[model samples]
Target: MNAFQTAAERLIQADASHTPCEPLRDLIGEADQIAAYRVQEMVTQARLDAGRRIVGRKIGLTSRAVQAQLGVGSPDHGALLDDMAYADREPIPLSRFLQPRVEAEVAFVLDRDLDVEMANVADVIRATAFVLPAIEVVDSRITDWDIRVTDTIADNASGGAFVLGTTPRALSEVDLPAIGMAIETADQVVSTGAGVACLGSPVAAVVWLARALATQETPLRAGDVILSGALGPVVPVTTPGSFCARLSGLGQVSAVFTQGEDA
Candidate 1:
């Protein structure tokens, strides 16, 4: 196998076995962002060949805080597979991840194809069928979360799984930039943020994602779920517990994590 393909296979194995691997940069000698995304595509294609369906996409690092933490100035993305989706309040198996964390988000369900360059917030709102509350379960396979932009991009933006809320609201029903989120564990409210924390607004994040995909000849399709990064700080899934997120005007979504059990 070529270097990229070999790296892709290693990542697939790492994900399947729930084991962490050395960063791709260490293996491939300082791969740039372009090279990392190429590895991501290769790995995603392998999953497709294995019968995993691409249900949607996820944007990461849209929050300035997260970007600063990761030392990146721009957002990254990953493909979302059908198997990675969960219903609200569903139990998530802890054994399926190497290391996991959860973050609250606003999810956009698209109603039409968005393939144009320079998409705006209005365009995104127009294209979206509805917005729902979501929780993204992010995991890292690059040993100890020691990752650069390239490292994460190649690891499918550190995506693990996601759960969607039952209630979906039209954009007109709520102010996108002013929506609030409270992410709580069983004990206390762990983190809180507003929709503006996500690149000013979640719709703006979607516009960025749509334009990014359009440049690569891929359009945001109808029925696709787009996660608009984190609305608050990400919390580590260190113990088994129920986690819930309440979004202003949108409703709530949650997930349970259990040790040594299948979800």
Candidate 2:
């Protein structure tokens, strides 16, 4: 098998065995981003063949500081499947993830398809039906989260699951770049940020994603939920508990992590 195929199989096996594998950067090289994406495509196809339904897409590394840290000028994205969705306050079993972390962000549910060439921020806004406060539960199949840009891109951008707020607001009702966000675990606020932390604004991130995906011929479609990058820092969830995030003007959402199914 080719290196890309080998990398994809290793990641797939990691997910199945619940054991984090070594980084793919070693096999694909640190700068070969195109090869990294090829690995992601292979893994995505494997999941689709296994009957997982695609629900949407997720933008990652939206924070400029994170971009610099990862040495990438643009954000990366991954597919969102039906199995990776959890309702607000729903009990999410901890066993499904190897090393889980959570981030607060805004979610846009598209009203129309975003298949146009060179989509702009205006196009994204026009296509968005509503926005919700969201929490992206991120996990890395790479051991100890030892990922560079290429490594993460190949692991489906480290997407695990997402919980969205019940209430939705129109684009006109809120300021996309000014909304405040805070994530807490019943005791205290762990992380806080504003919409501006996400590539200037979440809407702008969606525009980037639209253009990026359109180039790959997998354009965003109506009813697809887009998880814009994190508004603040990514917090690690090491224990069984609940994390709730509140977005000013967008209500709140919760992710309850339980030890197991019977917990």
Candidate 3:
């Protein structure tokens, strides 16, 4: 197998076993961004071949804190499969992931297909059916989270699972950039942020994701839920507990992680 395919297989195995593996960079040197994306495609395609359906896409590293930590100026994208979605307040099994963390985000449900080469914020806003509060459960296959941009990109942008709030608001009804977010665990507020943390505005991140996906000949389709990255710092899922994120006008979403067996 080629190096990229070999790396992709290793990632697939690691994810299936819920076991952290050494960084792919250690096995085959460092992959360039393009090569990393190719590896991601290979891994995603394998899942598709195994009957998984693509439900949407996720944008990562839109927050300045994550960007600075990863040393990347731009955001990365990942495919969201149907199985990766959890119902609001659903209990997630902690044992099902290698190393999981949760973050608050605004999710956009698309009403129309977007495939333009240079989609703008207005275009994204127009195509958005509604905005909902979401919590992304991110995990890394790379051991100890010691990953470079390429390592994460190849590992599906560290995408794990996501939960959406029950309430949905029309895009025109809310101020995209000024919306505030508060995340709590066990009744204590753990993190706070605003929509501007996501590439100035969550809408802008959706726009960028649309344009970026267009370059790959993939269009954002109707009914697709786009996760516009994190609005605040990520909280480590070291223990089983319930975590909730409340958005200013978008309502709230909660995820419960349980110890022992998979839920």
Candidate 4:
């Protein structure tokens, strides 16, 4: 095996074990895109072996600021397991994550496949069954996100968990771009954004995610839940309290972080 492939295997082993490893020792930096992605493939396979269901996928770096910060023009993709998904308004424990943060989002539940080479935004709308408001709970273990973009990508796009809200809308009725999100905590409005914040529109983000996944020969399936990444600002889920986000026309979605296992 090549050096990157070897390092990639080691990195997968470290994260799967939840055992810390010297970032440089594993040499994740040496991994190419395929090698890095292989780490995720292995990690995800382990999750599957452990009985985690393959629920869907997620689109990351949809936010402009995040894209700029990561030096990526578009976004990256990650897998979502059944265990990693939560019902809207569910209570989550802070003890379950390395470091969790929340953000508002637009989520799509697909009714049809969208792997066309020239798939347009309208194609996404038609293929989708329902659109809902959501809050993505992102967790990173790469030491304060103090790593390169490649590192995060190999680490499964920093994906941990996500919550999709109750209210669902037909793709035909709502305007994706103009859908506004009100993200708040402790009675203070932290920040706000719309679907447009996600690469002009969440549909565009979904398209990018689809195309990228195709390169890996991984197809987005029907009934798959796709989180269009975070809109507005991301807030740390440190303190125990109620965290909520309301998307205009799409209604509300929330998660409560309690001190102990309220599961």
Candidate 5:
């Protein structure tokens, strides 16, 4: 098998066995982004073949802290599958993830197609129907969360699951770059940040994603939910608890994780 297929199989096996695998960077090389993305495509196709449906896309590493943590200079994108979505107040079983982490973010639901050659902030704002506070449950199949840029890209940007707030606000009602965010778990504020931390603004991150997807020939469509990266550092979901993140003006969203026995 080719290197990309081999790498894809490794991740698939890890996912099926509910076990974390070693980093793909070693086999795919550290900086070969194209090769890494090819592996991601293979993995994505495998999921599709198994009847999983793609609902939207998610941007990752938009935060400086996340970029620094992953040692990547630029951001990456991933497919958000229908099975990866959890409703508000829904209990997420811990058995579904291996070494999971959570981040607070702003999510955008598009109203129109973003099929232009390059999308700008204006295009994003015009296409967006509304925005909501979101909690992204990021999990890595790579063991110990040890990943480089290419490793993460091939792992579908470490995409796992997401929960979105019900209270949606239009762009005019909230300032994307100035909104504050605080995530609390176990009744303690665990992570805090502002919209500016997400690639200057959440709108800007969407713009980047739209343009990137356009270049890849997969444009953003109406009703597509876009998770615009993390506003703050990701907190590890080590224990069963609820993580509630409140975004100023955008309201709040919570991820309630439960043990397998409770499910």
Candidate 6:
């Protein structure tokens, strides 16, 4: 019933399959908090109905630059489904995306449910069974995608798919903050970062993500995967021969893109 919901319903109707669609910025005008969340809620359900099974969750805007880029001081939350996750060294069909990019991150596989305020930074580390290096493939459906912050929020915060690497260490064995990550392309190492990039430590991002999910009456369940946010600048997918990321304790995860096909 809000401008954003009205616009989102129309947008989903136009491109429910996740293909590129016209930006509904004009119809949305300046969306307030309710409108912003409404759009996200609608898209979340639409995705589930489209056969995307909710696997876990992801937190975004952990970095100051990302917050500024998205024009919000706070982070946002979105559900990650099984179909959205990829194994290391797997092939991802680029044609399935509108405009997809990758982010290096530390991923956690939780051993127990993290419910509401009951879950804190320390709780996150304790509940985490293992940590691994990951590459999240983010996609956007809006046209130009050069819009303002509010536009992206209404666009479901650009929630996309993710690919995880081998579990290199148990959460209890290593320090999450000290974890390092390097993203490489066939050309060279495009970016290097650390786990601390995720707001002091990855747990900090997890705490925030769990709390955000709690607000929706959805408590994070046991065995759910949580991506603590990007550890470095997001790299655009131009010519994808192959890409891999190495996290300190985590081994590595990779994605290969064949030539002659759109990447």
lDDT winner: 2
Q: What is candidate 1's lDDT per residue for 168-226, written digit by digit as tens?
A: 99989989789899998876999999999999988888989999999988888988999
How large is the C-alpha RMSD of every model relative to the true structure?
1.4, 1.2, 1.3, 2.5, 1.3, 2.7
Candidate models: Cα lDDT each = 0.89, 0.94, 0.91, 0.77, 0.91, 0.76
TM-score of each candidate structure, all chains considered together:
0.96, 0.98, 0.96, 0.90, 0.97, 0.89
The per-residue C-alpha lDDT of model 1 at residue 194 equals 93
Compute the lDDT of residue 73 as modeled in candidate 4.
71
RMSD of 5: 1.3
Candidate 3: 10-residue stretch with minimal lDDT: 24-33
Q: What does the lDDT read for residue 236 in candidate 5?
A: 96
Where model 1 places Cα greater than 4 Å from the true spot, the runs are 28-31
At residue 49, candidate 1 shows an lDDT of 92
Error of 4 at 80 (Å): 0.5
**Candidate 1 — what's its lDDT?**
0.89
For model 1, give the 10-residue run with minimal summed lDDT.
25-34
Candidate 6, 144: how far from true, in Å? 2.6
Instruction: Tell me the lDDT of candidate 2.
Output: 0.94
lDDT of 3 at 176: 72
Candidate 2 displacement at residue 81 in angstroms: 0.4
Could you tell me which residue pairs clash in candidate 6?
none
Runs in model 6 lying further than 4 Å from the true structure: 10-19, 29-31, 258-263
In model 5, the clashing pairs are none
Scanning candidate 5 in windows of ten residues, the lowest lDDT window is 63-72
lDDT of 3 by residue, 1-263 (tens): 88888899989999888778888886456638888998999999999999999999999989777778877789999999988999898888888888999999999999999999899888898899999999999999989998988889999999999999999999989997899999999889999999988999998899889999998899899999999999998999999999999999889999999887774
Model 2: lDDT of residue 18: 91
Scored against the true structure, residue 214 in model 6 reaches a CA lDDT of 75
TM-score of 5: 0.97
Candidate 6: worst-modelled 10 consecutive residues by lDDT: 254-263
Which candidate model has the greater TM-score, 1 or 4? 1
